[model samples]
Target chain A: MNIDAVVDFNHWRDQARLLLQQGIHPTAVNWSGQQQTQLAFDSPPATAESSRAYAAGQVPKNFIKLARAAACYRDESRWALLYSLLWRLTHGESHLLHLVTDPEVKRLRHMAQAVRRDAHKMHAFVRFKKQQINDREWYVSWFEPSHLIVPDTADFFVKRFNTMNWSILTPDACAHWDQNRLQITPGVDQPNALIQGQMSDDMDKYWLQYYRHIFNPARLKTQAMQSEMPKKYWDNLPEAALINDLANGSGQRTQTMLDQAPNDPDRLRLKSKKLRQQQDAIRSKQYPSNSAPDQWMN
Target chain B: MQLMDKLAVLADAAKYDASCASSGTTRRDSAGGQGIGSAGGTGICHSYTPDGRCVSLLKVLFTNFCIYECSYCVNRASSQVRKARFSVAEVVKLTLDFYRRNYIEGLFLSSGIIQDEDHTMEQLTLVAKELRLKHGFKGYIHLKTIPDASPELLKEAGRYADRLSINIELPTQQSLKMLAPEKSIQGITTTMSRLQAGIDEAKSQRKNRQTISNRRSQATFNFAPAGQSSQMIIGADDSTDGTILQTSDRLYSQYRMRRVYYSAFSPIPDASSALPIQAPPLVREHRLYQADWLLRFYGFSTQEIVPTVGPEAGMLDLHIDPKLAWAIRHRDWFPINVNRAPLELLLRIPGIGARTAHKITRVRRHRRLRLADLQAMRVPLPKCRPFIETLDHTPAASLLEQDNLRRHFIPPVQQELDLFQAPPTPLVTAP
Candidate 1:
């Protein structure tokens, strides 16, 4: 097996191109992300001949973009898949990329789709908490992404949240951004670098409140919810804790709502104001003005 | 009330409005800006509620206090639903906080009219203004504009909000008048026209700008780049499916509305006796969305969709999709050759979506298509095979002429989703 000992997509592509130039079949190559180069004899063949050989084989611009994205996927199989497609494009099946119905192409498309979903999910579900690190406020989040997409997706976050200093830690990789530039590094097994608590102040409490109320009890489709934001993601979400309580108590609430007089004039907004004020007063008494981390209202 | 308590009350009040889209805005980011947000392009749903609805935007009412006695609304003056209001600063802080947490896309700041329409509109606008200016937040903001709100405030709102919507509430003017006496059909339409004008003006300014140093003149304001949408409450009034689609078609054509959200009348606590006691079936709401899509994409006019005459008049065929029903009625147009059929003809086939039709057009250039080629594309073969002709596919000679053809496709009442079942294999093998 012609194993290329590198994690980078560019390196893999370079090796694959050389292999294609040398007329190496896909079945003879075993592409890997493992960082162990074989001896000089077994290393990737001379690249000088590949440039001339690759020029004869025309790869579609669409496939280049698609393969670039698919390459960043943590799956080792993507390299071989891309190389095989590359070999086929040059040798025989010039129009093979357009045949999306082909099983191999379909599998490649699904992998690319999964990577896209991973990047988009990273954009959506990374819950950043503010912390005073070395007296400078920084946002840190712990994300467990399904694929190796941090390098490709970090630009989106940098553009969106450039003003704030933040770090996103995942199992496969980590990304940190200051005001100036982004620094990506190899990831650790656990998120020991991130603070789990100490910054989830009153705003988080309000978030939970919003989460509890925003849900409609009458139309419960737990499967639909799970399908979109799967179980693995639920753990990191601050609002995830309320899903069960909200779900379990929804039926009882609906029954009570149904049992009550629908037409009854229950102007509780003003009436409940006094009771809420009393609770607020009690809260103030329990916690004096001098509080660490300050109130989240600011 | 405490901020959390107020948020709970306001969000609960706002849950009935079902428009949760946070997309189709002018793309911008906080890059080189003094803030922490970005918008435009596709909207991301950070969370999904158990009801299968996306929580893309932080949808909440600014206040639940209303002067109007709209019987359908829980927050109407006549209703006893608990009311709470957010101070502008509170809303801004909450929005920024939630956005930072990545729990929301942006804010959908709507309000119940407190003193007047202008006053409510101003309050909603201020929250968006502060989020943009004070925080430099480039995130999406959707404002709900009231009908009677002054054009000045609307212009101001359009400047700050990515999208603005005023719920039409009901399909017909007569039903609207009966249910919501405070709202006028003319006022709503006028607001829509103003919004349309603003959107068009901005678009043209951007398009036809005399580029001075690569930027447009300051006179051209970026006014609601995502444009305006409206919502219609189904089952609250006696309006039929025909009346609804007609209104929708008008809204789409006239106002250039981005979307007309169809909210199934949800049951609220302390419900008004004036309204229908029971909410419409969720299936009906689903059917309407499917039909709406057929109108927008499938080139089906309202008249053709809900037959102008018949026993099944003014109603969509609930058993099958509206597209399938239309295709069945117009069977003479069937057996269009898939290898050479144009997009419009291919679209008329029930199973072929826009994507498949486009794919078919592209794929046929390489080689002639067969039943297996279509199947590999996951075209719903059961619904499509009779109508389409591929190189190796032929329907039974009498299948189109048979009276039981439609019945054969329809599932027994037990299986609601059986009609959508994918074929197993080799129903029609390729030559």
Candidate 2:
């Protein structure tokens, strides 16, 4: 018995439900993507009586949530694993998912965690470039996520950037927002030519300047930086180009700062006094603290 | 100066502050507003600099022109660094631009005393006000509160900003007086106390409104919904880790601070003869953070982590983490049964974290846990082996009593000779 290609969690859940209703064991059904020998036996048709007996609500809510996340994982074995867990939960092992030490449960948990982490990284690393399209502004970005998470993360981008026209292009799928609705299309191999050409904008220059100066040469932790912002994502990041130069020259910069001589204390005292006197004159105006509007009072 | 140059100078001046968190704010998004931003998820680190500091927010000072000469500050009035100030409109534009590009979480605007504390505080608050009220921006905003600013200004700043912070600058009042002559501990704490009162009042009012409405409406008043946090500069004066942790502990309990950042004093370009020329080791700051976590989350007291009457008094162990150090000192508490121990005892184990400890307790309900089970859960066995007892494995009676137990956990010294030799060839390389 072979199932059709699993497109997403919904597809997988529908197929798994049919398999469960037909009383087919998880091992007996071969998901289409897996490279396994075909089973010789044909699966019996699912019946209404079995379906009524194993209604969707009978499974714990936690299993559904975990299954949804685990199904997003890129591994081919996920469908079988999820089905096994679901089958056990309905077959008198209702407490199966709660056992963290169980090997199958642990495997599912790890896969779900990986999917979540991939989505989080997508949120953090996506860089949008501004472009002019037909006298209107559009923000475009090119990202390569590790899993089928483009659809899952579309709502986040839409909610945050609803006022702007933007598109996130990825190899698996692409998400676009047009102020009124979100549209997802098939994946692209390359970003639009306009986005590629306009990657380096005036804002990127200022961003690079901010990044260079904000770094503290006195405390260099290259390993820590690499762990969080790995080298794989550096090619797309404008600020990452300066990382090696800044890290390499940090030692010399710190030494130069140390080599500078201290200013004269007597002159410093006089200068400080002069500044204080100047500030006192300005303070004489006594600006009212409540001068600003209190719109938040309501 | 150009906006680019000012950004370089002001950002350099502001890098000394260690707090870049943008989480724990009220959940909001620009769904129906005229802006394009959101907040209130786990804080996102858009980038990390080589110093390992997260660039979660566009952290910059509004101005570097100062009227007070703090000995440790780069922007002190007496320092020879270039001075620059951003107009309120300029800051608003910069914040919006950066946020739209997804380059930052939001703005963390601090300033030096341009004319006086009140003027500087007002300028800082106006940036947040412009962002929230004019643009309807829902992104995170953190404002640095001037200690001597009036209460009304503080209240206004809290209303617009998600988080507010005032640097304690030093551990004790004496040190603050000696170094930052114009700033006082009383002024800082008094402002913190006022912020705390506002936060509490708004919280209770929100509770009452929720009860009255019997619904979780988004219209409740928010006053620094992320609450107040503060920073203390370590090694600025001669204050020890003991004194520093004690100050943080006090701030946590007394003022209800959400966090207390410990920044190691780094070298400034214009040397201040009154302060040290060299910066402390970065590891010292890391150890202090670990010890701080034990205080807040691990149910450990300040005295237990750093005792008062010892040769190593007032100092954290520079080599090993504070948790392992405490575990070695209190050997009698070891051999805690993994399956039967309470959450608190499980948390005390060297290798088990809060999440892992909770997982252990939950797993043990169905079946007794063994050493292999812990390994399967990804707990570091070597670190907690002698301290924890499992169903299948237990440490010998003499293992916990060994005098050399501390050395076992300390990472072995790196051998420079190995680097000169050729690396060992892999027996089987992956295809």
Candidate 1 chain A, run of 10 with poorest lDDT: A289-298
**What pairs collide in candidate 2?**
none
Cα lDDT tens digits for candidate 2, A110-208: 988889888888888888888787988988888888788999998888878879999999888999998988889999987556345645456888889
Per-residue C-alpha lDDT of model 2 across residues B1-431, encoded as one tens digit per residue:
78999999999989999999999998888886358798999999999999999999999999998877678889887788888998999889988888888899899999998766788899999999989889888899999998678999998999999999998888886787678777766667778878998899888988899778887786767799999999988877888888889888988998889999999998878867778765776778899999999999999999989856556667787667788888888999988999888999998999888899888887888899999999988999999999988989889888899978876776555233334543223111011
Candidate 1 residue-wise lDDT, A1-298, digit = tens = 4475657778877787667677666666667635454432264444342432666338877788788778777777788888888877876688987787787887777788888888888888888877778998888888888888898889989888888889888888899998788999988665544445645545678878888888988777788899998888887888888888878887887777666565622243245665345323322332223321121111
Interface RMSD of each: 12.1, 6.5
- DockQ of candidates 1 onward, in order? 0.26, 0.39
Estimate TM-scores for all models: 0.88, 0.92
Taken over the whole model, the C-alpha lDDT of each candidate is: 0.79, 0.83
Top model number, DockQ: 2
